[model samples]
Target chain A: MEHILTAFGDILFHPTVLLFLVFGVVVGLIVGALPGLNDTITLAVLIPITFAMDPKYAFMLLVGVYTSACYGGSIPAILLKIPGTASSVVTTLDGYPMTQRGESGKAIGISTTSSVFGGLSSSLVLMFLAPILASYALKFGPPEYFALAILGLSTVAGMSGDNVLKSLIVCVIGLIISTVGMSPQTGYPRYTFGNDYLLEGLPFVPMLIGLFGVTSVFEVAEGLKSRVKDGTFAKMTVPRIGKVLPDLAMVKRLLPTWITSSAIGNLIGVIPGAGMIMAIYMAYDQAIRANKDKKFGTGVPEGIAAPEAANNAVVASSMVPLMSLGVPGNSTSALFLGALMIQGLRPGPSLFQDAPEVAYIIIVGFFVANLIMGPVGILIAKFLSGIIFRIPRETLTAAIALLCVTGAFAVGNSIFNVWIMLIFGILGYVFNKLKLPHSPLILAVILGSMMERGLYQSMVLSKGSLMIFLTRPISLVMLAASVFFAGAPLFSMARNRLKKRAKRGAIS
Target chain B: MKTWKVDIILAAALIVISVVSFSDSRNYPDIASHFPVRLSIVLGILALVLLVKSLIKRREEAMFTLTGEQFRVIVVVVAAVALYTTLLGHLGYLSSSFLLMIGMMTILGFRKKTVMVVTALCTVAVVYAAFNLILGVPLPQDFFMAK
Candidate 1:
């Protein structure tokens, strides 16, 4: 604990790290305020730039972006009735109504307050729980780790979006891609297609930029003519935002709601692939059930508070799994994992001990970021909303296009990554158009290597015994849990279908 | 035109890819082939299920036909990006980027010439400065500089 605190002093006192954190907070707000951009794209674009800096400050900048993006999303949600980020969708339920009632300033206040509270509390949760979780995970054997990877893979059911089978297919495709590099055990090339570059496998950063950033540009391109013709472009009208912080009385009044939502959000964030959108929905649902304000979505502060708090809580706790088990909890956490690897820090149990300073800095930086997001968010609320919305989509789209190409090439200074990125970007765009979820695919790419490592090691240990997974208690329990997660959704779907048929028969 | 038809096509493609992958993995050494072989099998099964599911359900999702303008905009953007990639090492970062941004912005319906130029120039400059000076990362050299 003392060492962690001392590391905090070391990082916080650094001139460059402090400046980058502040820069990240401001940039995060603007990025999250604009409808065209969000956390994923911003992080994807910025990862290349971070490669030039000290790893600690690099991480601090990215963490700063992660912490504040969730809060900045609420600005547009309250004002324009358009969610700047997907998680802010729930915030729109009450936020826009609050604006209609001339309480836009109040709505922003509650959102900012709840976001800070959730962020700070969850960062603390990360600081304390990461050590405990890492120690527990350290005891996991090869079989247990394999089963845990399966458990992570099982999240495809929750994240698959309307079509579970399609998601599974895409995820398997990612696993296939992950197989392109040399085998970890034998060092034999598998799917390199005779290319020397394939020996090291697909580059992670380029793949991410393709999937998140460049694909977004393509999708935005498809809508360009429509946006132009319809004149339905984003407006620059800044909404009324006065106080930086919510009233003390209001905070006290909604304290229980905030606590409940934050706890629920943090729990959701801890689970691999239970994303922020789900947390918002779950927290919003709970708040609806428990709220005394009867007005509900008609613009109660609790409605905005619940989802904002929950979503911000997700930002930090999502890092928990990535920090502890090295298994990213969701797509954003997967990016954070990539960032850590880029910084020469492996994100598993050894990371906590091997680089205590780096780990502590990230955790501590997350806390300070939230402290900065509130005051900075309030100060710039008017300025950002007014300017960001007015930035033409054409300009933004073109910039993204150029940045994607440059960012992909920045790493390894290889133009080959540019070509690979183009392919993935097209794949992403097509996948989006087809309504197939790629989160599972991205998760599979990251976890596929880990899964194969564990499976192979366990096989070597057991001498080809398939029972290794079932024989060990920890592995057996994890396998059972994976089975439960995989089956429960399908079982419930079947049960619901049967109930619907029975109800129709009764009516007939 | 139905989305289920698209699903069938995609599922079949997946199966074909899995077949190729499975065949390829079979050529790898035993120790290296373990994961890919099993994964290929899983892929085949998943693709087959997707095909069968689409056939059974046969849901007709509305086909969104793009306008000529929209199609042109997309084509222009894609072509611009491909051209940018090809020319990066030749024309250099700033020179090629300026052309790509201006061309893309025009195609995307940014009609204000002065505003477009300023925005495009500023973007290229800032991105160059950030990536080059601050980060000390190298961009593609100009053809003049290269020679």
Candidate 2:
């Protein structure tokens, strides 16, 4: 704790780190305020720019963007009817109705306060929980790690969107791709095909940029053309606010909803693959039920409070699994895992011990970010609410295309990486067309070597006994959880079928 | 049924990849080959299972088909990017990126000549400055250096 505090004190005062944090918050706000672009695009496009920085600053920037984007997204949700990110969709229900009722200023006020409360509460949760989880995980052996990897991989089925089977196939493909470099035990090359670049397996950052950055460019282009055809792309105007800071009485009225939603958000964030959408929806549903007159979806201030707080809370808590277990709970966290990897900072059990400063910065920076986000949001809400129009579509497209290419090329200064990125971009486009979520594949790629290392090591440690996995208690429990979670949807489907049959029989 | 065709083809391709990967792994030392070979087998089985499931359900949706104009734009993007990659060594980062963006913007119908040129050039210059000047990443300088 002393070490954490010392590191926190050091980073808190550093001008450069503070600057990066503020820069990230500003970018996060604008990107999240924009109707279509969000922090995912921001993180993906800006990764190359972060390559030169210290790991701590890189995270301060990315985490700043990650947290503030959730808040910035609500600005548009309240002022415009469009939710900037998918997580903010629920915010639009009450937020736009409030705008309709000429209470945009109050709506923005509740959103900023609720978001800050949720963000800070979850940062506290992250601060205390992630370290404890990492320490306990440090006790795990190779078998336990292997079981944990399987458990993480099992959650990919959930990240698969609606096509679990297709996602599983993509996940397996990533696993196979991870095998391309050298065999860890024997030092023999496996799938290099005589190419020198394949020795390090696939280049991680380029693959990430290709999968994320370029794929978004294609989608943007597609949407742009469609808008041009329909003539429906109207320029939006920025909103004005009188005062956005909520009073003590309003905060008191909102306290219970804020606390409940934050807890729900934190819980969902910890559960791998449950995601922000579920957290926001659950909180929104609970808030509706809590109202005496059920004024939700009809311009209630509490309605904006529930989803806004919950989604912002999710921003920090989702990092809990990623920070401690080295497994991301959702696609957004998966991007952070990519950032961590690209920074050459290995996440998980030893992360806190290996680099106490980095761990402290992530937690402490998150807390500070929530503090800074409140005022920054209030100051910028009126100025930034309808920023979606000011950004030109063509320039954004061309610039992102340039970013994606150069970012891929800058890694190891290889044109082959550019090729790899383009190939992955094409594959990513196809994946999007097929409705396959790329998060599982990205998670699999990141975790593939870890799983393999654990599996092989456990095998060696057990004298070639496959039963080593089942025999150990931690591994056994993890294996059981993997099975239960992975098989959950199928189990529910079967139960639903039986219930439907019973109802049909009763009606007949 | 038409949409299911793509799924079936995808499954078949997975099976093929599994076979190739397994056979290739056989050439590795036994200690290293175990996981890849085993994982390949599991993957192949899953692909087979997916194929069977799709067949049983027999539900079909339309496959994605791009319009001709959209197809042209996509090809132009891929071609421009590929050309940029090809030229990056000799033409240099600034020159090639400028070329690629100009070509793509033109194809995408950015009609104003001066505006497109200025915007494309500024984009490259600012990006080049950030990466090269600030980040200290040395971009390819084939155009400036006398080879």
Candidate 3:
């Protein structure tokens, strides 16, 4: 506790950290408010630049971006009826209607206030919970780690929404991609095909930039001709924003909702692959049940508050798995995991004891970022309305493409990485066109090497005994959880089908 | 075309790839082949499941189709990116990037010549300064500099 407080003060007084934090917030707001850009792409593009900075400062920037982007997404959802980020899709249900009633400012205010409440609450939770979890995870062995990775994989595959088979296939592909370089257990290369560059496997940063950045550019290009021909760009006009602060009574009415939604969001965030979309929807459902007197999709304050609070809560708490167990909870946190590895910081139980200064700075940095995001995000929402839409889509698309190319090349000074980025970008674009989920692929790539290494090490420890995993208590529990997660959706689907058949029989 | 048809095609392709991968993994040493062989088998099985599901449970939902104009725009963007990457090696980062930017904007229907030229130039300048001067990261050398 004392060390955490000291680290908190260290970041607070440090000019460079404070400057980068504020810069990250402002950048996150602009990017988040842009429809195609999100925190993941921004983090992917910026991670290369951070290779030149201190790890602590680099993470402060990332934490600030992660904290604010979730709130920034609500801006367009309120005014333009287009969600800047997918998580804010729920905000549009009531936000656009509020705009129709000339209450855009109040809607923005409620969103900002609720988002800050959720962010701060989750930051407190993260601050307290992550360290304890990390300390506990220090007891885990290779078998346990392997089972934890399997659990992560199964949870993501299970919760992937109506396409578990497709998700599992992509995950397998990603794992295969991860195996391209030299084997961890043996020095022999698996699939390098004689290229020296392939011996290093695919470069992580370039692959990410391609997936998040270049793919976005391709998507924007796909929409380009239609948006131009239909005059959608010309038809867009900035909506008027009224007063940007909620009154005391309005805050009081929203207090219980803020607490409930934030708690829900944080819990969902901690679960691997559950994601912000689920968090927001679950919270919105809860808000509807609680506020029966107020109609939900009719511009109610509770409507915007529920999703805004919930998503921001998810932003802070999603880092829990990454910080504690070295498993990423979602794609964005997976990027953070990549960033940590780039900084030569292995994220796990030992991270706290090994590098308390860096670890605590990130945990405490989330608290300060939320404090800064409230006012700064509100101010940006008020003033940047007209400016945001004025930038032409063509220019934005071009700029993103160039950034993707340049950022990919900056990592290793190799043109090969640029090609990798292009390949993944095209792959990602095709995945989107096919409606395949990208989360499973991304998580699988990040976790694959860890899983394989743990598996091999466990085998070595147990002298090729297949029962070693089941014999260990921790590994057994984790494997059982993985089995449950992997099977739960299928079980539910079967049950629902049976119930439907029973109902049909009753009707007959 | 129906989405189920597309899924069938995708699943078939994935099954072939996984089979080939599994066959390739067989040539490797036991220690190196262990994980990949199992992973490929899993992938093959999953692909088989998807194929069966799509075949048996066809749906009427339309596949994601692009309009003519949208397809043209995407093709141009892709071609332009391919051209830009090739040019990056020959013409260097600054010159090739300027061309790429101008080409992308024009292809995307930006008609303001002065603004387009200025934006391209400004983008090159900023990228050079940020990546080279400020961050000390190297960009591809200019053709003249290489000589």
User: Per-residue lDDT tens digits of candidate 1, residues A1-508?
Assistant: 8867886786677878888888889878876764434677778778888887888778888988888887887887786554556667668768878876767778888898899888887898898886564455445677876776787677566434346778788888888888888888889998898999879999865776676666767767787678777776544244455664677799897788789889978876776655676567556656755763366668988889998999999988888878888888777778888888888889977887899788888888888899989989987775644554457778877876776777677666787888877877878777867777666676677678778988989988999899989989878987897787677667766887899999999999
Q: Show the colliding residue pairs in model 3.
A: none
What TM-score do all the candidates reach, one by one? Answer: 0.72, 0.68, 0.71
Fnat score for model 1: 0.73
lDDT of 3: 0.81
Which candidate model has the greater DockQ, 1 or 2?
1
Local distance difference test scores for all models: 0.78, 0.76, 0.81
For every candidate, the chain B TM-score is 0.89, 0.91, 0.94
Count of clashing residue pairs in every prediction:
0, 0, 0
lDDT of 3 at A38: 75
**Model 3 quality (TM-score):** 0.71
**Best candidate (score: lDDT):** 3
CA-based DockQ, model 1:
0.51
lDDT of 3 by residue, A1-508 (tens): 9878987897789899898899889878866765445788778888998988998789989988888987888997786554666678678778978976878888889999999999998898888987564344445678877876786677564435567677778889989998988888887887888888988788876776676667767877777777887777545555566578898999999999999999988876776655776567667756765775677677999999999999999988888888888888788999999998888888877788888888888888999999999999888887755454456778867976787788778778888888888898889888988878665676677678879988999999999897989999988987997787677767877888899999999999
DockQ of 3: 0.55
